[model samples]
Target: MSYKNILVTGGCGFIGSHFIHHLLKKYKDINLVNVDLLTYCGNPENVRDIADDSRYNFYKADIGDYNAMSSVLKKHQIDCIVNFAAESDNNKAVSSPVDFARTNALGTAVLLEAARQAGVKRFHHISTCEVFGQLPLKSKSKFSEKSPYNPRTPYNAAKASGDLIAKAYHHTFGLPVTISYCANNYGTHQFPEKVIPVFAIRAIQNDPLPVFKSSGNKREWIHVSDHCSAIDLVLEKGRAGETYNVGTGLEKTVTNIADDVLAILKKPKTLKKIVPDRPGHDSRYLLDSSKMKKLGWKPKIKWHEGLEETLNWYKNNPKWWQPLLSRSNSWK
Candidate 1:
């Protein structure tokens, strides 16, 4: 298949930016149209290498707008649409459920409608494992694509609703859609509000590390680079109307994650404090990504190495993150 033009929503955000960088490097002929709202998390600087590239284009627009999306789709001649745009932060979602519903759920519907109208070849919905709700830490079975949706937080509920809408489009309209539910992604270009980068920033500043919900909550972690790699594989080779799980299979508690971050930063573990957990915080989240692996896709980056690289990125790029950290409302 000679894929040419592709659209990646939320392109300047963490995983989306990394995905765009990876795609541009690997596929020489592919032209990219990245649509993002420049929300608190979306930073164009994250993809500066390709900013000047002729193959890449960006539009600062919200996906919730149908006419704007339709215009962009028609103008770009987009062959594939990767829906990565979403409101993902738990705290933010709690405080602003309406915004979450608008972006994650309704915005996805708008994109699907546009893709259907534009007759795109493939539409991939990038989602999180949190939509499965809390998996018990002691449970032996990991969540598969067959798991029932049980979103616990406003953020995840919105995402779950979006997934349903995508599924509806695929089944009802035959929109040629695929969904990939991924574990918690940690890597470069991630905003500081997320767990990994937040801890790294706090540790770097010798500040207190806030451990929500006793720091006992466990989660499977995947590198954003590995995530992007899987997403690319799916876009290029995946079967339509199917859901794939993307993860590193590394399940560790929040405390363990904090310890690892401290070790990476050469800081004492004493910096961590058990703080009040977020409302409806999932106790554990793990995904069985073997389905994608069976399709010849596997994660390449290990957590330790990936974590070290992420720490180095934040340490070296204070200019990029300092301004982000100063925005207390966004971070909170």
Candidate 2:
């Protein structure tokens, strides 16, 4: 797909900012517009370096607002649309499923309609492996594109609904849309509420890292940069109406990941406090990103190296996270 302009929703957030950075560096000819609601987790400072670029534009808009999003699409002449905007906190979803449904599901539908009317060439929707719900450790299998919908959390359920909508858009209207389901992403610029960053922030503050389960809950880990690369490949070359899984295929226990973080911070792993697991916490989840690998996309940063680099970024960005940490309840 030959495209000159791209529209990215939620560009100020974790994966979206990384995607913007990757796009700007990889393509000099394309113009990029980022639309985000600037929610608590969404920080514009994450994109301060690129805010001044002539080819970059940021719109303080919500994807849930159809009229506003349509106007932005018409104004920007967006050729490609990547939807990453969502209310993505598990705790928040538990607290407010209606909010999750509105943003992740209804908002995606609104964007799909806008993209269709704008005659966008490519529409890529970012999704999560959590949509597969919890896989049993005894099963010893990874979820593929063919995996059934078994969402266990409100957040994943909303994402699954969005995925279904995207698929229907392609099937019914012939809208050019591709969906990418990805594993857990960790890197710099992530809000500290996430697992890795939360642990890093707590460790920095001399607080205990909260471990919800026995620490044996298994998960697939992938670097955020690797995920951005995979998304790029999918946006550029992925087949429409197809779903691709993106991950490093590196599986590790939650306990081991926390211990690894402590090791990187040069702190003892003894600060881990086991707590009652979250309601309906999935025991294990995995993804088969072989389809993405077949498209010539593979992870560059190893887990150990990436984890250390993420730790150091948090250490240096005290000014960036200080205010956020003060208001957040994760540490307490």
Top candidate on lDDT is 2
Model 2, poorest ten-residue lDDT window? 323-332
Residues 33-54, candidate 2, lDDT per residue (tens digit)? 9999998789999899998899
Which stretches of candidate 1 lie above 4 Å from their native place? 328-332
Q: Indicate the worst ten consecutive residues by lDDT in candidate 1.
A: 323-332
**Candidate 2 Cα RMSD (Å):** 1.1
Structural similarity to truth (TM-score) of each candidate = 0.97, 0.98
Report the lDDT of model 1 for residue 213.
66
Residue pairs in candidate 1 whose N, alpha carbon or C atoms collide under 3 angstroms: none
Q: How many clashes does each candidate structure show, in the order listed?
A: 0, 0
Q: What is the C-alpha RMSD of each candidate to the true structure, in Å?
A: 1.2, 1.1
Number of clashing pairs, model 1?
A: 0
